[model samples]
Target: MLKLIESLIRYEIRQNVIKERDYVYVRNQLFNLLRIEPTDQDISYESIGYPSDALDPILDILEEQHILDGSKVARDLFDAKIMNVFAKLPSEIEDLFFNLYKKDSKLATDWYYNYMKALNYIRSERIEKNEFFKTSSIYGDVEITINLSKPEKDPKSILAASKVKSLAYPKCVLCAESEGFAGNPSRDSRDQHRLIELNVNNEPWYLQYSPYTYYNEHAIVLSKEHRPMKINQKTFENLLELCEQFNHYLFGSNADLPIVGGSILSHDHYQGGNYVFPIEKAKTLDSWKKDGITYNLKKWPLSTLVIKSKSKEALIKKAVSILDKWKNYDNADLDIKSYSDDTPHHTITPIARIEDGFYTLTLILRDNQTSDEHPLGIFHPHADKWHIKKENIGLIEAMGLAILPARLKTEMAFVKSYLLTQKQLPDEALKHKDFAQKILNEHQIDKDNVDEILEQAIGEVFVSILEDSGCFKQNKEGISAFKSFIKDELI
Candidate 1:
């Protein structure tokens, strides 16, 4: 059966791998691939010793194309090719993914991610260069991913993207209008892009994997209607619903406001994938019971409240209640503002995880109040930390992974060279000199140990970035302020 499925996949690929891949009969053999269903021939992968996956032949062809060279980006390009086949060719493709879920979710999701990769939608080189560091902080032993994935946008392309004179097409990329969008100076061809229609509590939504997957099988679940992001009971309900469908994956949302929100707040969506984060391992530091639901505070720097409950309703209800309360609850002494003038100013970055027949929702309390001294959100990364990451600390970063810009790679290399031999700095290195000098002065870096020290320095900065994003300081005074709030307001 597996062999036949592999053969069918290959045949399907041959049919569309070069030309326009999408056709009415693109996935004619999908249903037959399911062993439980019918097939062209009454055959199976059982000569008794055959590999059950039956993909060896197709893999051989991929190797011929050098797509299997794991260390380089070509292997990822091959992955993109296969995924393009999957995305462009599958019949009733939406349900095909769901059926894969019914058959083997891991297989289905793995394929989906591969397809996203093939599109070059998610650049593999970026994922390949990611530097991981496990550092100790008040949040315990936290692991951070230094994101070197994204390439800088071209100036011409940026200018072209800015002059979008029409919304007649996708209001933004997240809009369903982009399903088969043709390429333009600003927009790329979406002829091979695909989305799976899914129903969450009978409410329709669409699922698609992110091309630049920051972690394993990173996916973006977008709403049917393009709308501003809203965090409420419905958001929790939707996240839980996705968990029920793809329980192997976890789902999270960025806050709805700027400074702490996602880059795309114009469209309502949530990010889900098989990736694990340090926040997942964070143990509960404090908890209190209210209506049979236990709200636990994570010991991390970010003010995360963990709600653990076996009952979905209880978790949702309790989360919404606290969300509403937190929006209005504020203490001047703590410098936490719920609002400025009539503008509303409080939200939560919510994440949903299910295990042991229980639902655990982690909510990071967010306040986007800006001050004269800190024009960005007061809790945002201050100027000192801006040298590392100046972008918003969205849901992914708040969870303990740092998606630093790609420029850091070149800049860091320059800094390392200058420290090792006092070599002439490049024009770009000039901007980073102040930061590099501070490091040189502190560590007195020498050639023998420059690499090790610089690597650790970046990790240390990551910890500080998270701390800057935290509403509560990691210091004893901030801890006291946090506890005071719980005692005075939450409990």
Candidate 2:
């Protein structure tokens, strides 16, 4: 039942019913919620009347409220009692979160993200060192950080695996089961791991620092129960709800499908933190206004629109409406097909933020259409630009920072050497072979400035790759369709 309390506290916090670290208050509230009156000696509760009809959870909204144990109405309560003490683990570093919230509400999340980074907990298992590369671009400065965080299996361990029993104990790395579990061969090392609790739309979701942080204060939001990632009106509601709490942070989810989404589609989650994205910096231009909702076109290559409003409800409504249109939106001329067979080919990666008393959402349209030439996806990175970034341009990349593979560390060095000396490409450098001639054709390079030229070239390549991911081409035809869509104001 400790798992139940841990899960429920996370649920309550995510639901915005209670702030973290208010155990006595939460403990008392539980008395009323679970309908279990505390004994007269239980002096902690009965003073304040919280648990005051917090809204029903997503389960009940779907008409699947589970009360099979003797027909009890849970009143949106948990399955465990907070006061039940039979030697359970104390909250991990949550005491710190509580006190920080008292001094300053935003300080909890701020401190936690910063603390994780300082402890090297964020980069502990994955990155041996932080390696970053940057370049200037028309939109802004484009930075690509090489992630050498992949967990490599030891040769001895791989050989011993057949002799040992493979277990699915924690289910997945993101599961809360790893919160205090010991490390094993198959799973990641989580010795220094920690998760900050957060509520999203009356459901339980957790906010934890991303060890593979691509941006400052980078973090991930995961669901309490292991479930598949989903996108719906509830998702928009949660994003806005979370933005209200973490007013300084930007939160967004990836497309649920592969190719057009994130690396972890199996677990329902969102990526958030107190960092700004380049797309966020793009000025609102060629705009459309309706019901006081400002729909401005972004300057980035990816097809995007920033909708700003003072009314949170109005903006959420607009987002859901636009998402609907984009889901069924069919523009064959622009090569956007919503559905071919039973699979959906179109979706939206929506991001939310609160700025200057107005709520803003950046909606990125995505389409997954694979062709023989571009078998990955016609909307993904093209062949010419594949040498730099061959992976999917998910939420992080969509936000203007590209996370290239670990191989680029060595590959870029070889390319840099080639640029300094006009020597033929080595036989071992096959992946980056043809790419050199293209680079030489684009720029007249010399040793003195070759390094700077290569940096600029990489930034240009990132921009082009993002543009390739755009649902509508950035040319006249694509822009026309985009303008037409907003002009219609489908949402």
Candidate 3:
């Protein structure tokens, strides 16, 4: 009977009727139904409001297994109460609920509890940091600093205009106001900082920051409000008019499909910037000159688009038509099994490449989800640990410092080492090594020497992993294979 109740609750939770926020209430009700107090509580259907008629049969089954007592509840009763709540929920909510529940078996019941804890931590940290900033008179005058203190006033209008809703749970720690403000002062202090604010045809515009920028000059043009709409001729024309003001500029959008990662804003916007290097190198194809439309395929991890026309009006119309087609075809809710058929609008980042005195365009699509077979989600070492004293690990590593490595080695060595020592090398590593060797051969390296170098690198990486579980083995072969794959793909 307890098992049946547990199954029911699980189903309901997955169905969405009982949300994570309501877990406390549900738990309380279960406790009441069981008539169990904190001091001497046990699992039993009778204690938990089971009908008298239903209790006998369940009791008999429990007695047969010697798993129940008249005065105390069965252990499975606790499980059943939770499961019953989930089972009663509607279907739409089931997938996300179950997915999260199954993600960490031991912590399923503590989902809301953990989230609240994280939120409290974020709030406390934000208050503590902001209090310092508030008292620091030296940097208090900047608009960015002021904005952080009053983000609610700004309201992320662009995201709201684009119809992007905040996470249903609440308080997105990923791009919260506190996180943005925390980095504002240093970013504003940079020497090359230039604010490129633009108002498109008098429509209110907001600035957008890029995620993982590959160029010095990168930003997005966003609508004043968070809303969703098809990019029409007027929209494109306005953007094109803005584009003409700068020679080295590229424009892109999230479209209605699976929006690109890091575009947390739901506002209608287009990303653009004046990059230092020739953006064309990032494209895949050599040239895209079909009739009036041109497409330049970009290198891996870079996507772009370039349109040339006799008149801005014509260009805008063409671009709008192309985008509209993509939007219609790439419906997010559709379970389009064939990935190749999916539209590129939201999945790929488009980059405009100019090469050999001609304009070209490139598109770099999202990585294939099926390719990630690792048991753990995509997480690097030290992913969870936050460094209060240092800057971001990415920036530090990029600058050739090993602050993270040193800290992990010294502070977290024991646990890290244990994790690494337990992992068995997956077979895919060998295949990747072979593929890397092929790339080296093509590059005119001696096959034996290349293999030796790769083997040595792999062994060293593995040894490091064994010593510090926090460190992942650097798969040089996998890196080489990825490079080769990208080259071939672009060709």
Return the top candidate by lDDT.
1
TM-score of 1: 0.79
Can you tell me which runs of candidate 1 are displaced by over 4 Å?
Answer: 1-91, 118-121, 130-132, 141-148, 155-164, 288-291
RMSD of 3: 21.9
TM-score of 3: 0.33
lDDT of residue 161 for candidate 2: 45
For residues 342-367, write the lDDT of model 2, one tens digit per residue. 88888888898988998988899898
Q: Candidate order by TM-score, highest to lowest?
A: 1, 2, 3
Q: Cα lDDT of all candidates, in order? A: 0.71, 0.70, 0.34
List the candidates' TM-scores in order.
0.79, 0.78, 0.33
**Model 2 TM-score (2 dp):** 0.78
- Pairwise lDDT winner, candidates 1 and 2: 1
At residue 183, give the lDDT of candidate 3. Answer: 18
255-332 per-residue lDDT for model 3 (tens digits): 233322333434466656554333332234334454465543222222233455444454555555544433333222
Alpha-carbon runs more than 4 Å astray in model 3: 1-197, 207-214, 228-235, 259-261, 276-279, 282-291, 297-307, 327-491
Question: How many residue pairs collide in each prediction?
Answer: 7, 6, 59
What is candidate 1's lDDT per residue for 1-491, written digit by digit as tens?
Answer: 34544444444344333233442233343342221354345333323112212334545554565545322232332333333445544345565567777888777787666655544455565567777667665566656566666444466456656776655577788876676555454555554577877888777788887756777788899988989999999999999989988889999999998878999999999999997788888877677876667777778778887888889998898788879888897778778888888887889999998988889899998888888988987888877777777889899888887787777777888989988887788997787677777778888677888877787677677778777777777678777777676656655
Residue 349, candidate 1: alpha-carbon lDDT: 98
